[model samples]
Target: MYKGYFGLKESPFSIAPNPRFLFMSERHKEALAHLSYGLGETGGFALLTGEVGTGKTTISRRLMEQLPENTQAAFILNPTLSSQELLATICDELKIRYRKTGATLKTLTDKIYEKLNKNHQAKLNTLLIIDEAQHLAPEVLEQLRLLTNLETDTKKLLQVILIGQPELKQLLQRRDLRQLAQRITARYHLLPLTKGEVGHYIQHRLSVAQCDRMLFERAAVAEIHRISQGIPRIINLLCERSLTNAYCSNNALVTKKIVLLSAQEALGDEYQATFWWQHKAVKALAASAVFAVIVSSSYFLGQLYGENISEKSALNITAPAVNQVVSDTSSPAIIVADNEKIPDENAAKAITDNTAKVFKIESDGDKKRAVEQRIVKTDKPASIPMPVENSAEQLSNLADSKLAEDKATSKVKEKLSVKAVDGVSDDLLALFQSAIDDTEQDPQFKNSANQVVTPEVNAPALSDMPAWVQSDLPSLSFEQHIYTSEGESWVKVNGRDRYQGDTISEELVLNYIYAQKVILTFKGQQFSLPALSSW
Candidate 1:
């Protein structure tokens, strides 16, 4: 709208990347130099990427224009094609003829190869330039790579240049695409223009459009840079809108105010609402929200941490039994009591809650033993006299039983005291004498000195059996079981006692006294014989 008013031949700020209106900022020159050098060195591939409208496409076109007269270039404007479609498109771009009815990817590729060979024979280089190359699929890009492989030892048949947004660089970096990426040989990321370049950039375009004087104020150029962030496409859009607004008002030069208003209408909706974050109220609101999230997270985390504690608190026993267990000083009760001080307040609160279930102890005995077994194992003082008790009537019954026991003991002593008789074995005499002498001799055991005791072994060992055994087994003329320094039990026989002096039998030995039998060994093996009958 303002081109005529500003003495311009046409719209200078059109977003289309026209060659006549091209402005090569310093970075653009470096990028072009890098990519051109790459294509010159190897006929493989070159990569040029940039933000939207940073002039990647325009610069690539410039590269094509700069190619030698012997070079034939194929430009692909839209790369969003399948492998077969892309191969056909490449053939079309190179003017390589193929049967359109049966053009498979292989057929199209073969035609391209023939063209490349023909170009090589004629001393012409083939270059394929794909704009917006980021949209090319992995398989399609792979197909392009295969075309580059049709080469002689000196150079690739196809010198490919890939131009796209920054995402093209990312796409090439894929694990599947690294082979193609490595062949690129050279790559450059075109950045947006600097704030200072925006002024010169505007004047260069104005000059191309036949404008002799500066049509935009200095402040307006700065505003343009701010609104567009130096992106070429957005800069052109804002400058165009600003020019229209200025023309509507019949203003001579586009001002900063015009650029600002134009940008408000152009980019307002897509822009994020972040300015409010600087306000005190909004900052406070965000802080509160963060605090709430943290608190909620901690609460759930605490519950997860307390799962073990809750499991330990669950007891298998009934409530009354659990209360009884708590009275004991074992580790489980103490650990449950100490859970109140856990660092996680919520966890601790749950564990120490009054209504929480009580848990059984972790001790192996606790898991396996019956209640009675556990009670008997304890060192506690109090216990029920459930099985046995002391009383006057009970004492009388015990006294009668005691009297019968004494008469029986007396009869055993008398019988055991018999002298050797004809036909009676001499071995019986020593064993009988040992039994007679083992009767209690101490005043403490005198009232019931008739308890029968076994003499341990041959002669001397009989006195070394046990000290308590000596109290009931009084010292007699014959060998007897008696206390001694050695730990082994010993017994005497009339035949062996006279010769073998108090030596214990280290091997299995037995002595049968009528129906009462005794087994003894030096290894401390003892046998409890059943009660002898009164007969």
Candidate 2:
């Protein structure tokens, strides 16, 4: 309804988990890094704990997006079944076939071991990630612990990642579960967005939704942070409601008053309107008619910045029932699109808002071009023309003959009587001369005759810059180490070579490791790091 008014392609504040709208704060990045390391590193269990809607599932999808080709990962969203059933789920996820459907626990374990062993033999790493794992019974948890027992002399064969809410930490604290807790090698807690992060989160989603205009001002974001307590899910709910109210009221911006109205609609009658009315400071707002705005604003502001603490009784449980199939193995090999998005309520709303559902919206020329450009995947290389030696040569000769004829006719009619240099045709001379001045004046040109005629590099070729010059990066002196911080001495790049052993400097190592040269190594076997510099 307000598409034309605010000039948004879609509703920006929907609460859905669209990967395109994912704004990784410092904390979220750390959490993702921990999870990535846990799976990549050959070690014991990796545990991830976060409150409900704190983006655990989102992180899981992101991890899947980043997982290496050789690493076979099974994400179990529900783990409430018996030990045998759990084993079956893992097998199903890994697509490993087992003969015995009614196999005993020991027999099932043996099958899983055999499958994992086979996979390892094939040079494939298996990672079992169990989400919402707090609901796993003590026996089931112990069963998982037993699975990690299979190992080679150097490192463990099966790596497991257990993710759940904070209650998972509490559950692990039990005396009986202490043994399970001891094996966790890497652990990270995912916290809610900070006040600043909340504001960013809102804007990030809005921009992603194709909105250029600011829907929420600074004051409104602060109000949202207070009410939602910086929880992404709550923030989403409030924002969605606010947008709905704004759309209905024909408001261009989601003002502080609008956010409060949305909050009251979401929070219900328990919140005191009189409390806001009594507060002289809040009542002095420019918008007076929206009475609930002042009261709810104060109430939530108190909640923000630790003025009011959330209930400790609010337990976060990883119910086996929270089953979401984040990745479908059958889905086009699950390409993580440069602009790919995970289905979230926010994205869903954006879709609905942009489509001919709520309003009849017509796109302009730029909008149509933007949409067309998005359809083109520039990140991916152009398709290779299949090799046909005979056909290629014949076509090339035909083109050359035609070019020669055109040049001969042009030379006969041209004003310049000079013959084409070195059998180069007049067309070729004109084409080269058109841009010759630019290259002649280039400062990088060593000498006119010795000018480096660099091969026309494609996007894919230029993308390998870092990998080519990785070894050339400045190295740190031995004494300069000073143990700034402990980082993984080795990283498994593209699962081909494990760059292990401590570098004199982590920064220097990382800079080289993430270079385009190194990244292009994984682009395909068509090109490798060694061949990158030769170009």
Candidate 3:
């Protein structure tokens, strides 16, 4: 519902593991790098462990998509089966044909070895990736270790990658699994994103959805981050429900109220405290109230002047003295009132006087300097004659005060600007303006620039377009030049490439670009399938 209202092409906050929406934080990137190392020419077992929903699976899928042309990969998502069943699954994934009726362990091992050797001879490397390996029995794990032993003098014939939750680390710590653990050449544990990363993660998803970044309020983002603890899966869950609540209400943008409702519903009773405490607006209000009280009280005590107040009356309020001043001979002395029958206000003023006395009393070098400055300033009465030839001093004081006032005003303006721009964008604001105009206009035929353009193109508009355009056509923007088959082809993005390719169509070039960039995932699995690129 909100997608239509907000002009989003898809639900950006869906909880499903969609590779297209994967965003690898710094920690997730390190995990990917470790897995990639294992899959490289220098080969061995690569171990990755993390909490559930931390994106290991997505990372694994991304790595699979990035595998070289001469590399074959098999993924086993479940590893809890018996040794024979596990072996059979691996064989199936590897496309190794074997008679199942009398398939003994020895026979299966031989077949796997034969297949690996054949692949090796064919100049191809094979990678076996096992997920949820924490559930693998010791026997099954031992068998997996044995597979790694199949090797030539040059390098191992097979590369194995094991991924699982943190429990997998404990599982590996078992004495029986020591040998297996020692064989792991590369290991990394994917950590949940930091609080700062959670904000970026939300924006990344919103950008992918093509929605207004302001879809989530600042308070809502904080609530989601606190409750999710920066875990990608949890963030997905909270964001999805929050969006759904907004959708049901037909609201284009998510607000703090909607987030609260969604949190109460989706997180149940577990995250009540976090949901409340992490609200940014609530925090700001609390801080503001505290600051207001402090400033008001400090101002009331630090400055005083009145029309009909006697010295005794002046001494009755908690206001600083206008005439009494400190001297250089002052020590750290406690002030005592001679009259115990003083008025209540006067008693309060005495307390303030005690504080001032304490301020004047110097106990050390820095304190002495500060106290001297205070004495010098407070000693001058407002009625005192202006010193001869002191105009420059007065001007300097005025300039400093004005500069302070300017800085404070600038800070307030900056804060207001930041709040306004928090998650808002020009495009979104224009779209909202157009929506309001359409609402006001009867015909709803507003031809504003904010209108969403349909993806389909009219054939007439492309009548002059060439069939075999140059690879570097103005319409195509790609880093490198590449060639593709005559039929439709897609660009595959990986990473930044300074080099260029030649003789490529726009569509093929796009596919290459997409393929080169890796998608984010959980536990090395692709979080979302990529959208098919337009040809």
C-alpha lDDT of residue 451 in model 3: 31
Model 3 residue runs over 4 Å out of place are: 273-535
Q: On lDDT, who's better, 1 or 2? A: 1
RMSD to the native, candidate 3?
Answer: 22.5
How much is 129 displaced in model 3, in angstroms?
0.9
True-vs-predicted CA distance for residue 534, candidate 2, Å: 63
Compared to the true structure, candidate 2 yields what TM-score? Answer: 0.51
TM-score of each: 0.51, 0.51, 0.52
lDDT of each: 0.65, 0.61, 0.63
Where in model 1 is the C-alpha error above 4 Å? 271-535
Q: What is the lDDT of residue 428 in candidate 1?
A: 58
In candidate 1, what are the lDDT values of residues 1-535, reduced to their tens digit? 6777777789999988787677888898899898788787454998887777888888887887888899898899989899988888888888887888977877887788899999999999888889998899999999889998988878887898888876676577799988988888888877777778999999999899888888889999977875676788888888888888999999999998888788887677753322546543475467556756887888699676556334534533221112234354442332222123322212112232332323332347536431210111122323322112234666799899979877766765565455669987886566555544643442212212233333321123334556544344322222223221111222233212211122233333333222132333333433222222110
lDDT of 1 at 216: 89
Q: Best candidate per lDDT, number?
A: 1
| Per-residue C-alpha lDDT of model 2 across residues 19-52, encoded as one tens digit per residue | 6667799888999899877765466788898777
